[model samples]
Target: MFCPKCGATIPDSDNKEKSGSKVVKNILLVLLILVLMAVSGLGTAAYMMFHNKSSGATYEGKGYNTPEEAAKAYAEAFANKDINEMLSCCAIESYVDNLDYEAQIERYGAYMPTIFGGPIMTGDDEATRQINIEERKGQLTNFIIRAYLRVSQPIDSPIFSGLALQVGDGKEYDADEVVDMLKGASDIDSIKVGDVEDCYYFLQASSNDNSDKIHKTLKKVYGGKIEWLGVELEIDGEDYVMFVDAIQYDEKWYILAPHGTGASIAGLDVYSGGICELALLD
Candidate 1:
């Protein structure tokens, strides 16, 4: 026993006790800080989601959990002519305010031919310009929501019926009236959605040196991380693919509009075709 005690040296029990206590205190301090950070982050995310919903910046209904779910919902909404459901499927309104209004107006103006046959008037004053911008935004929003419905649904569809556009020729016609005038037309009977494909490699392949700029712009507008998905759609026997820019905040996914050069950045040459092409009657 004596030899064993000597070998152990009964070494500094008080010092060992103090050292162990210090280590425990340090571990507890680190854990406390980690807990606080997690709580703060969660609170911020919750606030954003609530604010978006309450302000009408995003759809009030429950957001789709996955990108595929969002794409399918959009297709179903288009086929069913459910404008509210279609709006719920997209996150476009959430980030529309973040875009350059002038650039957006210019970009979307190209689609006016498909929706209306006249120029949207604007004034030179700043206040008038802003008003015009808001009006144009509303018109585009309506067009996007109703364009496909006009093609697929009958003229009796509640949303389209009695809604008429007066063109320059003073002739008033609704979507069905316009679509009927197109030659070699095949109205969309149904829409089928395909699997969602990742757009990372597509971005990497196309961005070249401006990849950093593209990514930074997206992050600034959307969030820290964005998921780009290409959803394939089969509309009335023809195949088409649409790019969906999505962002996840607070564990929920929201689809974003490809504002600015987002479509070009994604290597999408969005020519007038498919829905856009069919919407135009010349």
Candidate 2:
């Protein structure tokens, strides 16, 4: 039976054979459509994932030819004052010894304003060590006297040799000064020039700026927590360890010179933190 106007389900009037085949075909078609939809969706998802990874700038800017190449490149970037390029190369975390991001960034940024242009130039051919410290000159707008950083210790100590190294265009000390300074340290404090003939000495510091005033500056190198950090430097093409002593100069402690290598001083950066120099690695 069928309803008038509104067609309703009724007993099949046509052949059962035809109805059964049509029903199976329709169901199969629906299943095939579902399968195709699933495959299509999966394919689309995979393609999108790959595309996203490929497109991201962070992923697109790949890195160094090699670790050494990367380091040299970064150094060049730094030397050239290419801030963004250097930062791009700099690791998010360099090492356990490395300063945190804000501190390091601020430190590096400070160099940008002046260093890229040149070290201050002066006609005075004479140099302290190798640094022809052309006075801050016209660059420094605030001529107001900066608080002198010099501080002192209660005890007077014998000062020995000194070695100063100025890397880059600001090359400060010469090989001669460095050699003499190292040799002199032996006579300071102990007055015991060791048996080892022709001993070498190197530039010593915890960090870049805070040299010369080890006792005061050492505290800072350790972030005021530990006592000291050491630097490794090449001297006369030979390398040696150093223990520093500072003297008050102009209300600041200058490296009156260092008190030679202590009796049992370890090599540079052996314990203190830094990107250990090649000498240290060797």
Candidate 3:
């Protein structure tokens, strides 16, 4: 050993060169790790950006697989004959109409064959590649859907147009049609229940036939509570608020709401009668 106390080149057998080399390798490894961390962060950001762009939408209530999923859920409710289940899937505004879910269950129970067996999907405008189901759901709650999809086009609720067209089509109008329509229009407990003012002039083309009969039918159902409000439908065993979307023409009035629902009626043609299903609150 030469000059052991001085800083000088050591013998080849010493570990100094290897120690320096190891420190260099550690520095390189640290730098490599930092680079990898940066790359990982960038990749995460890119994934989030793409995912948000492709599959994200802001929703206030209820988790959903898609808008289509909600639509299908509504259909499933009907298919299972669980009226409350179907209503539970609906947006708040519909229930807010004062026709609470319980009323819907009682009034619509007799018509399960029509509601559940009905199609949840259909083509519009000759298969124009439209988002019709979403548009329909955006238009009406399943409780108010009707086969008179044609009538549902011009008017807001299929219940009204469904009945009008049914009567106009001469589908053997009976007491049930009148009862169903009147029931759908019955949620007057709250002011906004009947929204015909929000939708206008489509039924001007309806036959206006049996307007008096329609009015009387309403009175029969509500037990004439309107007094000056013309005919009414009886709540009878129902626990629902009632209101009407009435139209005056040829000196007669028509009722739509608690009396009208997506519930279907027999002996009616929904199309060509210028009626529509109730509007949906998506």
Candidate 4:
């Protein structure tokens, strides 16, 4: 063979070397294209999976366009005692998603009664049905909070009562009686409570004269176990610290033992405890 550009005679050995080099270069190019295609395919698959998992706030479902809408639909379903519809509005937490639907509801029953008024039961189907009925009432109460939210109502609004219940073991008080108990308590200037869904309560309290008075009052209400109600607000020129209380209770707000007042309720794990978020009404 001869070089076309230079018109120089070329050896067979040189021609063979050049041919071999071209073949190797072609092979390498093909391999690179294949690798790139594979990578692209994997990336596309991952993106599609993520997109499908997160259907966004606009998921296609009846009466649910956003999280708030889903919440309302779920609450309404609970009120109507439609378990299937309530479950439809809910996307299980990933950790608990592996559990079957009935199991999920049963697990939810631990804290379900707090927001959906009913007795917590285990095993028996009859007990489960009765609990479901009670939960409907609990769900209805929480829905009132949602109704307040849709109109931009503040947490301090009397339309929703303030959070002031002792979660001790006892017969539950009616809502009116609970409010009376809170109002009757001493050492607080003003208190306002509201519910954020069926999850938790928002509480705001102003100290009467100074922090000392409020602190003493809390000590009285809670019998010296009042470490959490330490919320304080300054009106004229006093400094106050606020406390967030999370307590568990019955259908009527009877006090549960105040141990696990953590962020259980808002996180939908209220079977452990309920929480009170205290802040200045300003």
Measured on C-alpha atoms, candidate 4 has an lDDT of 0.35
Task: Between candidates 1 and 2, name the one with more favorable lDDT.
Answer: 1
Highest lDDT among the candidates is held by which one? 1
- Cα lDDT of model 2 by residue, 1-282, tens digit: 776768885666665778989999999999999999999999987655533423333211244443333434433442343445544443211111122324333444553434311233323332421132112221111111110000011011111112336534557655665445334223222111111111123233223343334334333321221112122333223333223222221222222112222211334321211212234433
TM-score of 1: 0.45
Sorted on lDDT, best first, the list reads: 1, 4, 3, 2
Candidate 2: where is the Cα deviation over 4 Å?
A: 1-55, 92-282
RMSD of each: 20.0, 23.2, 20.6, 20.8
Clashes of each: 0, 10, 50, 20
Cα-based lDDT for every prediction: 0.50, 0.31, 0.34, 0.35
Model 2 residue 124 lDDT?
A: 30
Error of 3 at 212 (Å): 43
TM-score of each: 0.45, 0.19, 0.20, 0.21
How well is each residue in 1-282 modelled by candidate 1, as lDDT tens digits? 124645655547788999999999999999999999999999987756544434444442456687666656665665565766766655443333333434434544543533321224434443453344344445435545444544455334443445455644555556665655441223556767766665443234444556566556656644434665655566677555555566555465655542213334433232211132212211
Task: Point out the higher-scoring one by lDDT: 2 or 3.
Answer: 3
Candidate 4: where are CA atoms >4 Å away? 1-119, 149-153, 159-282
